[model samples]
Target: MLLTVSGPPGSGKSTAAAALATALDYEHVSGGDVFRELAEERGMSLGEFNALAEEDDTIDRDLDRRLREISETRDEVVLESRLSGWMAAEHADLRIWLDAPLDVRAERIAAREEKPVEQAREETVTRAESEALRYREYYGIEIDDLSIYDAVLNTARWGPAETTELLVALAESYDPQTDEGTFPVSGVRYEF
Candidate 1:
């Protein structure tokens, strides 16, 4: 049972995903962490990482390949990525999309990274735009779209624990083999 959590920058997707994975005893795989590790290994900054991803198709391909390989063996894994919803279509028992207000997201990023709010806001907007553009150009993927997901969540009102509880409820009600291609039990729709 593969589960995926996706959202825009600073939307608490990682926090919620980790909590969900822990509650369900699932392995957690994060694309953002993978990208960060890869970038560090190559001795590059975040901007450089985005730049390289834009210029190199091989990087994204390799990342996707590794994710696929992991998913094959893990019975219940929580995968978090900008493109997780799309990638997990075949394997995911449930896909969750986390959403938060821009201001809230900016605040979270600033506080978490210890940066000036204005600087964090600028960085967040830039990274978000760059990621959307590059992912589309490089892989024909639009992470902003929620149609690919089984559930859409607004994290602005809920804390990580509450969100995890909700996800667990959804997961408990989900039967992957029979529920394939079905929408979320919550029946919430995201406006593109």
Candidate 2:
């Protein structure tokens, strides 16, 4: 099974994906990890790298290409990234968008990075705008659209363990044989 987990910054996508992959005994691939590695290798901050990407599309393109390659060839994998849902839509068995309110997400970021909540909020918004602009200009993708996701969950409502347990259960219970069926969301299944 190929599962793609996507959401905005500090939405716990990477953590959730890793937990889900572990529960399912799947390989976990994180696009953010790759992006961060590149930034570190170049001896630059994430903000600097993101700014450079705005000028040079190659940075985003290269990372996206690597994600596509993994999705195309791999099975039993969990791919996590902001655009992973869009990139792995065709190959993914489940495309999940895990997010929370901007403030909640920002708070999580602040806690994780040990920065002030206000500072984290500003950085998150700036990074999101930068990526959104580039994604639109380069790929014609509207990142805000949730139509592609099979499941959408609010990470702020649950801790990592609970979220992982819920997702693992959902993945196991999903019936792939039912083509063009509805997905359960907050106890209500909505048909497409």
lDDT of 1 by residue, 80-106 (tens): 987787766777777788989888999
How high is the lDDT of residue 29 in model 2? 98
**Model 2 lDDT, residue 40, Cα:** 98
Alpha-carbon runs more than 4 Å astray in model 1: 180-192
Query: What is the lDDT for 187 in model 2?
Result: 36
Residue 25 CA displacement from its true place in model 2, Å: 0.3
- Per-residue lDDT over 85-188 for candidate 2, one digit per residue giving the tens place of the 0 to 100 score: 88887888788889999999988899999999999999999999999999999889999988888788898888999889878876786655553323353333
Name the top lDDT candidate.
Answer: 2
